[model samples]
Target: MPFERVRLERVRLEPWKRRPELAALALLLGLLMMLHSHIPNIAGVGSLVESLLPWFGVYVPVLLAGALWRRSPSAVVALVLPVTVWLSLFGGLLTDKSHPGGDLTVVSHNVGAGNSDPSGTARQLALSGADLVALEELTDQARGTYEKGLAKAYPYHEVRGTVGLWSRLPLSDTRPVDVVQGDVGPLARTKPPESAAEAAAEVRALRTTVATEHGPLAVYVAHLGSVRVMPSQGFWTDSRDFGARALTKAVAAEPNQRMLLLGDLNGTTDDRAFHGLTSRLTSAQETAGNGFGFTWPAAFPIARIDQILVRGVRARSSWVLPETGSDHLPVGARVSW
Candidate 1:
């Protein structure tokens, strides 16, 4: 009876030799599940999956090599589904830059707190000729340097907390926005300044009206609270989620239809936590950029946390600028009114 059981187990294992194509197909199906992140959102793993969704296309090359080695037409055929799905989702972005000529150009960057050359970074950004520049992670030490460096190009600017906005056009009605809830830090408590010049020193998120050629445009600059992944606690997105909810509510209540939001949201559009903002506004890069345009960890950008989102206005083109002193690469978008 023991010998018979061993023979049955060996027979089951040997099926791959007889039908390798079927086995490959099964593997492809599993890959498909991972590609779509069909798994449940248990303990916040689902958000992680969505964050890495674009990279799943990396598997296609490996699968193709396996199909060739096995000489299995069935295995090759099985790859078509994933290929189609991937192409359907990201193919347009791989194509050439089609749209051009924008009424306004906007740039956003999270100049790392450890940035070595704040003035140089500011100069580079100012040279981009962006009508508006939004910066996050602004430190007290580097703030004055950036302000001085950019003063020539961007005469009008505002900073609230760690986030700031610089514009070539006139700005008005600028006020600190309450995005993050819970522990209200010193960053969030900006005293009402007696003058416009000192107003930004204390602000984290700000809503300002930009006077454009077309009309007044509402622009919101924010640096949402960061998130972390801990072995014991899982994805720690509580602060980010809270800020998202608050920002969403503020944007929803805005009377202006032509609004722009630029900053380091610290979460991807695919993450459900950002649906509050994504559902209302359109991402500039997703709408018009040529490629993935990832813009974090400047050395090797794996994700795009910095964003340019617009409502009513149209994004003509969106792209990432060259590397800077900061850890995050700057992202820019050209929009038409």
Candidate 2:
């Protein structure tokens, strides 16, 4: 009887010993992920991993609960660090409630370059009742279609590089923004354009001032270069990193007090790469959105790359519009002075 009791005690303590190590590992991973923003050029791999980090917060608590139930006090304590960090980063999301209050309506859409149905996409965007519409990935072929389709509703419009802004109000001072492209090393300069037309197509970043009823709102529409993952390289986001930095500098230099940036940032607001932009602006969705507001791959959006950010204006309500023909869904926000 004594031997059996001792064996049972050992079995019970075995799980406790393992729990500490597991808990420690989880804590370490969580910390690394949290600090991922500090590591440069992680766009390819880091960005992808970071996109999923918010989900880990869900499992960490459950694991800690299990540890506590098993009477592992040390393990429970180990969990505290990660739990605190995660909550600090994402806790605000818990209290977000949709409240309607603004006067101006704005929309942002990526309208994938490869979209097969530009007309359908244009029609859907026009119906959103937006006072201002900003579009990215505006390839030459689709520009005319968009201009013609949207002209009926938005009489004032401007296109710079591959991005465009259409407004119910007049738009002026439109120009291309010079976002840094990664070091193609000497190769890019020397590599002749595939054709003269391809060389002209190179122009693709733009900014414009929308003359809203309230005043002139500086609007920036940009598409950061895409990030790619590779086995040997780990991650490749240098182009996006450079572009984001340049854009940040430009926004900082702008003379206007009120600013609105709408586009497919190629990153989430949570991404550190966007710290420059996020630090200066406020996300409309977090203030008045009802849900996560994911707006990519229209089939099922797990992440939000399309966004509407504002400064000097209050967000009344924000939401994603129904899918058009593009891969991304449209995002709309109501704002006021």
Candidate 3:
């Protein structure tokens, strides 16, 4: 009886303590994924990894489920490593936080170049009661529609090439910024030009001073050149990177302390290429929003290319409005000094 009891105690087994190697491998992969930004951009692969960096967090859930199914104590324990790392990186963004009130209300939208109803989009934005509105991808034919629609609400506005800014307050010293320096228009601009005029034609960025009740706020409205992933060329970001660098320089050279940058940057802040802009500006959504606040492809939004970033001010709240006629939804933010 004593020998049988001792053998039973020594041979006791559980399903949960079966596999440890699987869990360790999963955590190790997760750790590498967490440090994706530190990875090199060999043949532009690093930048590509950075672009999809945030999505890597999804792997944690998969690993979690596997760990539970295998019921391995070591594997479950290893999962803590990736879980902690993911939370440390993106934990702040997952929470819904906000301040009480704000002084200024601003909105930004891409409004889709092929949008069938530009006037309707403008009307929808005007109804939002925003003090300032910024629109990108403004086509030549649809520009008039937006201007006429928003004229009564936003009397002071400026348009340069495909981007425009409309404000209820007075706007002054408006100038086109050459985010993409070339003669070819943005629609035709895929690569750098050989003998194009400096900061001429196809301007995708504009800067102006807005006289608000709080003070003068320097506003920059931009539609940075779009990027793509081609089968032959790989991850295409040459134009967007060029534009981001130029815009960063322009913003740094700015004399004003308070600034607001509204645009469809065509890339997320997670991407390393946007360091120039993200370093200088703070995202309103990350500061005060309920969820991910994705604003592209209104039908089934994925990423937040359209953004409202502020500096020298505090954002009390930020939210993405309901879907409009355009492909992208409108994004709004409330800010105060």
The lDDT for every candidate, in the order shown, is 0.83, 0.78, 0.84
The TM-scores of all predictions, comma-separated, are 0.85, 0.84, 0.88
Pick by lDDT: 1 or 3, better one: 3
Where is the poorest 10-residue window by lDDT in model 2? 180-189
Each candidate structure's count of clashing pairs:
6, 1, 1
Model 2 spans > 4 angstroms off: 1-18, 38-49, 61-73, 180-200
The reply for model 1, stretches above 4 Å from the true place, is 1-38, 183-203
Candidate 1: count the clashes: 6
Instruction: List runs of model 3 lying over 4 Å from the truth.
Output: 1-21, 182-201
How should the candidates be ordered by TM-score, best one leading? Answer: 3, 1, 2
Q: What is the lDDT of residue 83 in candidate 3?
A: 77
Candidate number with greatest TM-score = 3
lDDT per residue, candidate 3, 27-119, as tens digits?
Answer: 786777777778876556777777666677787778778777777677777777877777777788788887778999999999898898787
Q: What's model 2's TM-score? A: 0.84
Local distance difference test, candidate 3:
0.84
